[model samples]
Target: MFWSAEADTSAVLLAQMPVVLPAAANLYSALREPAAREDEDGTHFLFEAGGQTIRIARLAGVPPEIPLAAFVPLDADGFDRMEGIGRLLRALQGRTIPDDHRLTPQQKRRHRHMLQATDGRMNGATYRDIAGVIFGVDRVASEHWKTSALRDATTALVKDGLAMIAGGYRMLLRHRRRS
Candidate 1:
């Protein structure tokens, strides 16, 4: 699930979204892509002007090679997108999604380390160092010094990244590598 920080919105990213490289993404380069659908036959997601795509099957352990039977149309809205996303997932449970292009272990680790480490922690500061390195403009002059800086900073640090939010923050810092 993805949260719209500014919009206070929570939604899951469809498995079939057009992601850059090998990750998942919306086909139209958008999370909420405008697609055609139908409640009767199934849902339809239009990737291109005339290319209407449907969820044939999900690729997980074993990739589903079949294409959707036909284009099923539906309403275009959060509720609709949400419902459609749900149906697609339900129908695709346990399927082997082709995430052949996901990040390498080292790359993901680096990304995590970057998000977890901040400039302050290295100096062994307190409260001001709460945000670690990613946060804290300057330990001495941090605007949040007087406020609940540490608490809020910790939240933001832990809340960094798509999977962090999508996975419901269940994943802990497995390891911290100094970059």
Candidate 2:
């Protein structure tokens, strides 16, 4: 379900559209590229294309009618791209889109650190505790630890970890073809 921040009508319109579960799944799978970021609610997706950022979210419950002429306000190019996506979904029907991709060595390392940070956070560890575990206690307690590069890095790691679990995990699989 796509909506504008300023309007509730779009949400209402989306809710009324017939539920095409496979299309929704395929749409999400197609959208969840390496760059995509999902909101904490697990419904919204944010990504960039052609240097423009895009966001789309799913509606919760189905409504009665989909209003004709309801349009999602996007730039012309963006609108065209969205139309293309709709066409692709119509063409594929219920067929699934392949989304597997291999994690690079760098990604693997970052993912590991992210998992560690996430685990620590879930276990009630403070940022300092997590930083100590990953970056060394001495380093975390140093004068530079306050407003330091290490602190910033740790915060970024936690945020990335949360984003991954939120929706990025779907795109972490090894792809059949190499880029």
Candidate 3:
């Protein structure tokens, strides 16, 4: 689940972008299955278009019926915001949204393992048990449990997964940046 600020990376803020006025204002009218949620900051709309979920947020004062402008900030997340908006625009234009390249194959595998390990731990499974399930029971049995690399990997997965559950999952929406 995403918190308010973290969700900004995924949700398009219509109030921030320069208004496309006149004809463009009717663009939102064609969106289907819009689910609106009212919050202190604004009203958020979730639309399903082109088999993708499009999140749009309008500031508190903006009328719910009127589609507001969306702005991309000049910050670390500028590229991420632009990418998200690009996907939304493509979906709006009846084009296919490309796959997200943020997480590569290895990262995807590790994330999947992390969630699996976390779930196993939550269900009272031991690290050895988790490793067995992930790396195959036969492979896990071939190595000494106390000093095996697979054992350490299983532990790390559970640790990272717990961190994600503690709100670190928000980072998934961001692009990696090196200092």
Candidate 4:
């Protein structure tokens, strides 16, 4: 699900952390079906555990076999980096990861609707037609097409979905801050 290295801020950076030889605790044994790749930046590992994907990165010069003590930077993204390290720690310790980080049911439903509406529009469906599918057909029929709130809602959903598809969805990973 994390398609881009720049967008996915959840990676636990091993190179930045303290390296321990003959590690007392290691991530290699605890992760499930870990997939690894090497690039100019580092060695990257992706795995699924505790109902979420865990991403780990080691910088180019770091040894791949060593265990790293989690190190978090005190910056704008400190909280997110801390959270990622916390999840990695829990996984390494054979402890259950908490599910409190997931999105709410309402947010999920709205995102679903946004994608559906965007799909309909891309396939040449009118906003009214999309509204009929999302809202009940009878409800769409009851309102005047020229001055319907559903029309505006359907339009907004498509616009929002398009923005997400255009890479704005990356914002979903970080905590919101007042600007």
How would you encode candidate 3's per-residue C-alpha lDDT over 116-179 as one tens digit per residue? 9999999999999999999999999999999999999999999999999998887886666546
The deviation in Å at residue 113 for candidate 4 is 1.1
Q: Candidate 2 on 45-138: residue-level lDDT in tens?
A: 3444443333444333422133212235563234433443443343335444332124567778889999999889888998888989998998
lDDT of 3: 0.76
**lDDT winner among the candidates?**
3
lDDT of each: 0.36, 0.52, 0.76, 0.74
Q: Where is the poorest 10-residue window by lDDT in model 4?
A: 16-25
List model 1 lDDT by residue over 1-179, tens digit each.
21231121112222332333444321322322354333332333332211222223122222122221112233223443343344444334523333212246866765575345433344454534545444444653545455755556454554464345465343231112224
Clashes of each: 23, 6, 4, 0
TM-score of each: 0.25, 0.40, 0.81, 0.83
lDDT of 4 by residue, 109-130 (tens): 9889999999999999999999
Candidate 3 TM-score, true structure as reference? 0.81
Q: Candidate 4, residue 66: CA error in Å?
A: 2.5
